[model samples]
Target chain A: MEILIIILLPIICTIMIAAVGRKSVFLRNLFVLIPTVGDFLLVGHLAWQVKSGGTAASLNLVDLSNFAIKFEASGISVYMALSMTFLWIMTAIYSFGYMEHEHAQVRYYAALVLNLAAAMGIVFASNLVTFFIFFELLTIAVYPLVVHEETDAAYLAGKVYGVYLLTGGAMVLMATVVLYCLTGTFDFVPGGIPALAQQSTFMLTVLFVLFTIGFGFKAALVPLCYWLPEAMIAPTPISAVLHAVAVVNVGVFGFVRVIYNIFGPTLYNKMGFGSVIAVMAAITILYSAFQGLRQKEIKRMLAMSTINQLSFMLLGLVSFSMIGMTGGLLHIYYHSFMKITLFYCAGAIITQSKNKYVANMGGLAKHMPITMTCFAVAAVGIVGLPPVAGWVSKWYMMQGFLEMGKPIYAIIFLLSSLIELGFFGPPIFRAFFRKEENNSFNFQQDTSKFGSEAPWAMLAPIVIVAFFSVLFGFWGFVPHGLVKPALSGLLGKGF
Target chain B: MITNSWLLFFAVFIPLVSAPLSLIFSDKVSNRFTALSNVVNFLVIAGMYSAVSHGKLLVLELNTGFNFKLSFMADSLSLLCGLIFIAVWTLTSFYSIGYMSHEHAQRRYNLFSLLSLAGTLGVVFTRNLFSLYIFFEILSVASYVMVVHEESFEARKAGLKYILMGIIGGLTLLLAMVCTYHITGTVDLL
Candidate 1:
């Protein structure tokens, strides 16, 4: 029953928001907050239950002899769901301030809510069929948000986003069909299906390539990263929620499920897939950081940063060791906090000051002290500084690399930290140190007040998420709690 | 909160929590405050040393998710480290009262010295690599201010090099811990 409602509620709320929005704008806004908040609670509750030795809810629909659609809140499912819905709540609350002047409120809210259901579906899926279905739905759901402005540029970005993802979807669907035929099952198992090891090596290799290409596109691994920065043509809210938080994460989560659930680390290790992924993710980490440094636009730089950061999680997943996997999985939770906070600040800055480039953001901190301060905190976290969430995960990732005897990946991670500083530092330095000539922007003091400096709505989520990034760093129980259980359960290792 | 080991927290955190307090008080008051806190801190650990020396294993565990607790164990080894840290801390509190009188930025020195003491005690009491790493990081970071406390040109450069080595050391320790955890499937020390 809990599983049914968890899956069904988002669609129900999306329909309600679309219908109620036509009658009252206030109701529409209220409706927008309900589903994400509710989803977060439901998902978080499921995570707690599963962590405390309760079996997660599993559901099946249209059972057709090994081809049924199934949803199960396994440890990793709850891991992804908890973070997605939590950030979804932030995005929902944030849009109230950021999207006030934007066009098409009804369509935006409806699509945003639907994206939540799709994300929840992808995470909770018990089979390749269910995972693929939700994965494709997420692609279609985010299109409206992608080309939200309906501008030529938005349309162009929409086309790139669609073309890249749809082609990847085709590859994944092909892989799923082949996998089901080879294994006579569509259900996902923690650690690869034992029967897969019996298949011909050549066939398994082909299937592996298909799944990698499919997930790698959305994961924004090097060659496929062009669409990510292209999609920056969308509004900052979409950039933050779908692009930074949800859409891209779904891609890495796919890599995670495939590595652990589908392929099993033993087979992944035997096939030398860790080395393959380490190379690809390593390339993406370096190349995208360089790309990020070249981008003059704030959101574009963040997009490049997202592409770089996503691979960090991807790299952790294939670390071929539990510790590496732990670091990678923890990163999925931690990066959302750091990256989303950054997007909120970037969006808030763009909206209030009309300054989008790094150079022009000089002395913007004096205007929006709260936003810039949060930006600096998140920037420090991204740089892997201690007592911020990013350091813990990166510390683990570095260890995972060393544990696997792949110190090269560890070196790559360290190099990215410096590059992260390079890309994130200039904006912060310019914001605080560089002077804005003829500055006329209203200075917002007393960050505690409502509607101060970019509206309480936007400021609140930015500050709260930033605070959690710090909290998760110091409060060992909160972020680390869920991840270790989830990863241990997946690896079948009792900690 | 586990057992009667609540005083273990006071041993480490009293020094930590009292750090910023020096900024508010004058030199004499700050000196007295530091002395009082360190004496209290020493007593907390010294009292535990009696039980610990008898192999009582004054264990305190804070729930940190999974089945893994952030357990603080004061066996003979940790009690020894704890006693030594707080003892030195207590001695310095008196010594610095006069030592800091002629020093510029005495409050700043007082503040970081207190912070580093707690960080050291936390390192001493932790039963696992993860908790030790946390306190070790704080200690390393807190020591940087003292490295540059003199505010001279050489002090700044030496401070930079000191912190760079500290960060590298921290990263190396983290790598070793990860390797240990990967093999053991737990961050705890046996």
Candidate 2:
């Protein structure tokens, strides 16, 4: 019950404030601030409880005398909830001044809170059914945020988002029904569906494909991934939440939950689907990395890169090795911080200097040193360079592939890392070292004469997250008793 | 006995009620008042979240004039969606304050926003396929007003396209629901 309150309080407060703050701008803004802090504290408390090895609280509500409402947090859920709440607090703080001059500041804040609440719900959900509900809610909640610009391009992007996700959502709904009918329960159990394991392999194979495609849309595996790059049409804060933290993470999280909890590695291994999944993941990684190299728009490149990086996590999981699952989970946090920094830097460049393309970013490092520096650190992290968080995950993935004796995947992983360097390295290098063109690109008065580096609101979150990229990397090196045990609980012993 | 179920029914009704209230108050003060009503309704929903989170299930059961009971339950899944609906409703309200500040029919917009939220909440909370269909249709109707809120030809055209596609999706959903109920002998979610 207490745990549930932590998630619901902000949502309640957001509505009350919006209603009451109608006439007073100061009051409205002030009202929004209260819930932002309140939710963060709640998440912090949950994290503390988890770190101390406390048992998670559970809540169940019965509806229509038939269905049950259930929520619980294990160590994994608590950690993820804390990550989301922490990022949300920073993003909300940033949105404060970022929306100062924008119209509909109230709506922006309200949407931010809603997105946060849905994300937290996703993190804490105890079962696949609950997870799917929040997953779809996340999809709808983000649509308006994406079309916040209300331009033709934004509208079109919103449409593509609807088509891809809604279709995928339908598949999830169908799969859930099928599973429920077979098992008579929708709760996530570690190891997987014992009942399904008893069924014919052909039936299980079909079901596995359904589950894979349903979850794969959000994971952004190729053919189903076109929606992600287009979704970059949303605002920067939205990009941070949707692409890096909440939306995509929910997809990846669902995939892990389904594989490890519903199917269990033992059965998944016996089914011979692990190799198939790995092959698809490797293809997506190399393919999207190649796509990222050809993009000129910084956000589009980052979006393509997200598809590729996401595949890295999937590849790690598909290896079914302990090292691989750990790599996958760590990458969830590491990739989020790194990608968010890159997106923030891109947003800052666009908003501050009106530069959206890499071709135009020559000499940017000199003008906006803080933004470019953060961008460079983040780029290194994304490229899997040492001492950065991305390196830890990539290293574990390599070990996982090797342990699985999949030499082809190990080679592909290395090739993909090099491709990552190919795509992310040159842009940062060119930003700093390349000479300014003699054309109109040079001698142009500093665009920031009108504004300094993006408002402190925006810059603060990016910088803090960049710092987290390094901090989490170091944390990965230290023996954290919590994460390893949690991974063991999910993956089982002998992992 | 039916009155208890009205609470769940009212979750959907409040928005439709607000629509008329907005029409009646179509002035500035009325718009403020309508916003206030929405806030109040949102708070009640929040209370529901708390009650549900506390392991209390708020079940509203109604006979659909057919054989089945039209039911709404605040389960974990519904609670998640309800939380999101209320949150988005609040923010979009604030946003509309800025985005639609100078537009006419501010009351209409607020009314429809509430209706959409209510409809969406109903879709998530209800366990019955029939009720889900009803709420889904309401959501479709209510959101169209938002898509066409600008009342411009382009906005109206987009709304039309949105509605047409939604209708097609709705029909598919309806067929699925009917097939499910026919095969299972109940529209209630297990």
Candidate 3:
């Protein structure tokens, strides 16, 4: 029941907000705050339960003769659920100011809550059926938020988003049924499902292809991508969560689940599927970084960079070792905080200075020092500089690949970092040293004026999440300690 | 294993079970009921997870004979796919409430969407390849209305293309099924 309520709370709030949110601004604001805060506490308690070495909290809400609807909060699920709720609360708080002037507040807030619920559902679902359900829900629920502006471009983006995801969903459904026919079960046993080993090579290969294409569309794997950058027409907070926290994370989670939970490392290695995925991820890493450099729009550039960074996580996951998988899972948490900080900063700059293109900002640092500082810090973190969270994950990922005797992947990792620096480095450099050619700043005047920076609601979350990026870097022990056990539980082997 | 055969059968055929009601009621009522049934279907699938994981499989056999028998099995995998199918359908229904607010033929859209969902769920739960093939075809036919929901010329053209491709695919699958059945002297893989 407790587990059920955890999933239902956001849904309940969504309905309430949708019903009463339009009439009273105070009620709308309160509706968003109370549910998000409640979710934080509920997930916090679940974390405590896991830390105390209790059995993972579970609920079987519907019981049939042959199956049941199951929700389980294992260590990994708890870790991710906690991160999701935390980011959600912060995003909700940030939305208070970011969306102040936006129209259709009711729809925006309602969809935001629904998206969180669906994201949480994805994290906590105990099996593929459960996961896929929430996964598709996320795709549909986010459509409203994506097309909230109701512009021609927004509608086009929405169509693109729908087509890509629904098609992916269909393939997933077909693969899932075929998988059932072969294996007779879809429960996510640790390592790999033993029954799957009995399948013929042709059948197994087909399943692999189906699962990859199904999840890859959402993960934005190359060739099947382009929808992600198009999805940038969404509102800034929506963009921030979609890119950093919710949608992409679910995609990577599904990919990792297929490799680690469904296929297991031993079988994955024996079949040589790891290298195939690693190669794909490596290409995505390099290609998106190059694309990032070419984008003129700030958000589009960040979207490109997100595709790049996400593949780093994918590469780490397919390393097929305890350390590699740990790095992969840990990167999910670390990247969420770090990339979300960057997106938040981007959104803040746009909301404040009305500059959507990077080229338009000649001397942004001269005025919005706080926002620029946060952006620079996150950019350095993303480039794998020391004492930032991104570096910690990349280090473990490189080590994992080398331990697996795959030095090529490690080299790819190194090259991708340089690419990251190439794109993220310049904006910071231009902000501080190289002033824009068409500048608007009055240097002689006091630049620390209150209005020069974004409002407190917007600026506070950026600074907080950025601080966490650096703080996690320095205190890498915390996530390393958490994710290690989670990966171990899934792999059924202690590192 | 406790096998409630009637309930299990109804779970897979719920869309057909509710079709009569859908046709009789107003669009709003039918939409709400269809959405409610999907939620119920999702819960039923979820409830079966523990039993399936415990190795308590549900097998419904039809036309039993010495040489061949038709069967439908509920295992972990089928149940999992069923969950995803119902989830997508339910969310689409909710989204359509808002998305189709200004559209005509909403009743037609809702009915076809429900029928497509039925075909999809059947495809997931059917144990034999022949039944699987049948459900796949049903899904293809039912989903045509969704493709052409807009009633625009482009929509009609797209719908025609969609049905043509679906038919071609169905024919190819049917040919394969015939060969397999003739070669093996049985249509069921299980």
lDDT top scorer: 1
Worst 10-residue stretch by lDDT in candidate 3 chain B? B62-71
lDDT of 1 by residue, A1-495 (tens): 666787788899899998889799899888777788888888878888987988777888778986788888888888888878888888888999988888898899999999989998898888899889999999999999889989999899999999999999999999999998899887777777778988988998998899999988899988877899999887788888888988899899888888777878898889888789889999999999888889999999988888988999988888876667788888888888899999999999888877788878876766787799899878878877665787777877777787788888887887777677678877886675456757634444442422336988899999999999977775657667777667866765411
- Residues B94-129, candidate 2: write the lDDT tens digits: 666677768865766776677677678878878777
> Clashes per prediction?
0, 7, 13
lDDT of 3 by residue, A185-294 (tens): 76777888888887887888888888888889888888777889999999989989876678998888888778777887787777888888888988898899889989
Report per-prediction Cα RMSD to one decimal: 5.2, 26.1, 29.1
Clashing pairs in 1: none
* Superposed Cα deviation of residue A366, candidate 3 (Å): 1.4
Candidate DockQ values, in order, are: 0.24, 0.01, 0.01
Off by over 4 Å in 1: A433-452, A488-495, B1-8, B11-63, B66-129, B135-173, B176-190
**How would you encode candidate 1's per-residue C-alpha lDDT over B19-74 as one tens digit per residue?**
97876898778888888889988888888866766667777777654334556778
Total clashing pairs in model 2: 7
Report the TM-score for the A-chain of model 3.
0.96
